[model samples]
Target: MATPLSAERLLTALRDEGLTVHEYREWRTHNRNAKGPWGPVHGVMVHHTVTSGTEASVRLCYEGHSTLPGPLCHGVIDKAGEVHLVGHGRANHAGGGDGDVLAAVIAERELPPDNDADTDGNPHFYGFECVNLGDGQDPWPAAQLLAVERAAAALCRAHGWNHRSVIGHLEWQPGKIDPRGFTMDAMRDRVRKRLGVPPDGGGGAPEFEPFPGAAFFAPGRSSPIVTAMGHRLVAEDCGRYQVGPGPEWTSVDQESYAAWQRKLGFTGDDADGIPGETSWTRLKVPKS
Candidate 1:
């Protein structure tokens, strides 16, 4: 329902959301705009490149293979969580998709099942091709996943759209299953939380709450900081709490924090739920 963002705006939005972006060769001027319309964008579309390694994938996307043409997508999200801009307006990604799904996306509501493909998504969506095996076995490292979230959130925020505006290629195409390792729903939840940003662009209205150290989370603790954290966890769809994330430090808080840790790609003892300085810093909890 809006015009496409300028290349400058695209870069600014992404950087504003805290992503490390790499400008590929001729990315600013590269596009398939000559082939069709490329405005009135409705949302963002996600995909997997079904390839391994960053440099090759980015190159392939920038210079697409035979039968697909070149500049296959606007950006290639590498496994390292770096966003490599390959092309600008109207890249070759987001081929035809379900019209019903497109309508739902325009309405910013729950998407209908994509059983038909009578729509040209190329003109209406911004495509991101993420490097992966698409085999479900390839790991989605925490950094990579977080980059996807930030990248998508950046666009949605700029457009004033919500998490609903982001959709997986699988959700748009019939018999397609890209972005396989993580559920779109979960990813949307992460985007929603990150998008909870106010005019200040998150980190609270002014700044994020400081990490209070592990000792501060001892049982029976009561503070608004704990409550703010709980809300953030819930927004991330990681709430393992039985009820309220009240101002008390209950096991519920630990369980929820663990879920967040796991979502960030931590595992085993590292995902043990307790907050570490590194993870805490990344969480960016709003000041109480």
Candidate 2:
């Protein structure tokens, strides 16, 4: 088995991975955490450009969008999955989120719901921005997906964290959505699978102890599920925890479940699993 990649070692690996590397001194820091460990990092966060090409996305990540001053992420991964380091140490990526979620992620505990963007995730997460349209229709090439998996798995190996720690940008923010079609849960699954971890035994997303309303919980029924799912799935290393069968729940009748859920309008979280609305819906189904 290979060793995990640290932030410093990650640089060498990216260089070795055949990607042009650039260091932005204008966006570097030491990240003083009064309440956390300074090493053995937790996990990786994946995102989509929502911009067009690789170069453009890279420039945007370094330059930042109008809403966010600049230096939006730590790295920009191209459509080919080649990583380009942008900023390091507290880059302006993950904003506010559930503190329990962050704590669980750091401890590698089962994730909890990210009800709001109230925490500073950038301080803890290693962000990666991949080139994609973010339109939910962009085709995720195997090469790009593989690159993401490699990068994430390498980090997991380094930090002693399972692939479950990895998440997506959309999962962190409330009204924001990037890294669309490729759900965080799906991404984590690939990373774990690559690391020789059995898909089932690995951690699942944190439980939303007190689930929201029926409409809020049901797939296609509310917007919160996607955001909520993104939060839980990434921490648990599952894909968006949507209501029915989807890419996230591969152990079950995946194809049929996804088909049914999509028809109901749930893109990420509103699908099935154990308890809660998704489970209720699935439980209601007649056993084959």
True lDDT of residue 282, candidate 2? 27
Which candidate's TM-score is highest? 1
Per-residue accuracy of model 2 over 95-165 as CA lDDT, tens digit each: 67666777776665556666776776756777787888988888888878878887776566433457678
Name the top lDDT candidate.
1
- Residue 15 error, candidate 1, Å: 0.5
What lDDT does candidate 2 reach at residue 259? 40
Q: Estimate every model's Cα lDDT from 0 to 1.
A: 0.84, 0.58
Q: What TM-score, over all chains together, does every model reach?
A: 0.69, 0.59
Model 1: CA > 4 A from native: 197-288
Model 2 clash count equals 23
lDDT of 1: 0.84
Error of 2 at 133 (Å): 1.6
Q: Which ten residues in a row have the lowest lDDT in candidate 2?
A: 279-288
The residue-level lDDT of candidate 2 at 256 comes to 40
RMSD of each: 15.6, 17.5
